[model samples]
Target: MIRSIIHDEMFLSVPSEKAGKEHLQTVQDLRDTLHSVRERCAGMAANMIGVNKNIIAVTMPFGEMVMINPVIIRKAEPYETEEGCLSLKGQRKTTRYRKITVRWQNENMEVMKADFSGFTAQVIQHEIDHCAGIVI
Candidate 1:
């Protein structure tokens, strides 16, 4: 049997006391969305782009990372270079960032921390922005 490649899990909205219907689904949607996010994050890993406000956001299996309420822990001096993303299609441009530390909770309610440098750092920032509902 062919395995499913769809993800529909949605993260919880901020301030649990005031969560809306989208944040309180029946569960299946949540699982699917989360799965899709991971897959997109992983598959798009090779194609992630550097930080560029002018550049379009990267595309993913579930549309986009669409992360909600994300925050950056630390950042290092930035360097400049061209960048690309799977979502950006066949394009590249100069981006900046030296090294950065990131922390964020996933749809599964787990905290993840990682150190990123060069291209990876930019990708993480891009993805985190996606998680926080940033399109660019």
Candidate 2:
């Protein structure tokens, strides 16, 4: 189910709750929504689709991935960059890490941890920020 992109700053500002196995459908929906907007967006959070759950979908060079309750365990090499969102107008300047290690759950609810770098890492960081209710 492709959901609508939420633009309400107040709603987007509120932090999302942790996702569980029961939230699997939300994960699918987030992926669907992300794919729907792939031409203009590279990633999306559950909150961006109006569901306040700690879920995010990102498009990588290989494929698309969904992260539930993602946490950034480590970050290295910070740099400034500007980003745009389907839920927000224009791009905003923010600091991002060139490399990041994250722990998150897959669609099956299994824990997965891995390191990401460059654009992929940046996209993950941005989506994680959405989960934390920080709209950059």
Candidate 3:
């Protein structure tokens, strides 16, 4: 289903962890939401669709991927960039890392980690901010 993108107070509020079986649904929802907006969006967070959970779906160079409870473990030097959100129009000036290592869970609830750089790193940072209830 194509969930509505939330831009209210809740969207700006920090999201909670989605653990156990409930996360399966949230993951699917995030995937669905990401698919609905992938054409114009690089990624999306659960809060953007009014689901206050640490879930995000992103479009990588290879393909689309889902992250559950994603956390940035390492980061390189900071760089300023312009980023926009699906829940909000217009771009905002935000600072992001040039390279990063993130740890997250997949749809099967398996833990995984990977390295990202350049634009991909910036996109991951932006999605992480949304998981923390930040717009920019």
Candidate 4:
């Protein structure tokens, strides 16, 4: 189901966890919701749909993919940029890393690590912050 974006304090305060086997359905739901809104959004987090799970769907230059239990392993050079959230009313200035190395799991639960830069890095960091309950 495509859930509506939430903005309540309780919803933003919820802490997400590493998505396990039990969260496969929720992950799929996030992915579906992401694709459904891809025309207007770059990515989405589980919390955006009232599901407090560490899952996000990001649209990269190559394609769209889901990141499960994503964590930034490395970062470099902070930069400020205006970012908008689907669950939030408007854009805000947020500090983001220029480049990042992220470790996350795939749909099969296999761990994967990749270095992301530019816009992709920004998107990943923004979604991870949502999982961390940092509304910006």
Taking all chains together, the TM-score of candidate 4 against the true structure is 0.94
TM-score rank order: 2, 4, 3, 1
Pairs that collide in candidate 3 are none
Model 1: per-residue Cα lDDT over 1-136, one tens digit each:
1123222222211111211224423123323433455543332211122111111122344543422233568887866655433344444554456788766444463566666676556765655544443333
Provide the global lDDT of candidate 1 against the true structure.
Answer: 0.40
Candidate 1 Cα errors over 4 Å, as ranges: 1-69, 129-136
Q: Give candidate 4's root-mean-square deviation (CA, Å).
A: 1.2
Which numbered prediction scores highest in TM-score against the true structure? 2
- Model 3, position 116, has a per-residue lDDT of 93
Q: What is the Cα-based TM-score of model 1?
A: 0.43
| Tens digit of per-residue lDDT, candidate 2, span 1-136 | 9898999999999999989999989988988888888888999999999999999999976667999999999999999999988889999999999999999999888899999999999999999999999998
Please identify which of the two predictions, 3 or 4, would achieve the higher lDDT against the true structure: 4
CA-lDDT, candidates in order: 0.40, 0.92, 0.82, 0.88
Of 1 and 3, the candidate ranking higher by TM-score: 3
Score every model by TM-score. 0.43, 0.97, 0.91, 0.94
After superposition, the stretches of candidate 4 with alpha carbons farther than 4 Å from their true spots are none
* lDDT (Cα, tens digit) per residue for candidate 3, span 4-100: 8788855467655665557677777777878877789899888887777888888976767888889999999998888877777788998889989
Candidate 3 TM-score over all chains jointly: 0.91
Where does model 2 exceed 4 Å of error?
none
Worst 10 residues of 1 by lDDT: 46-55
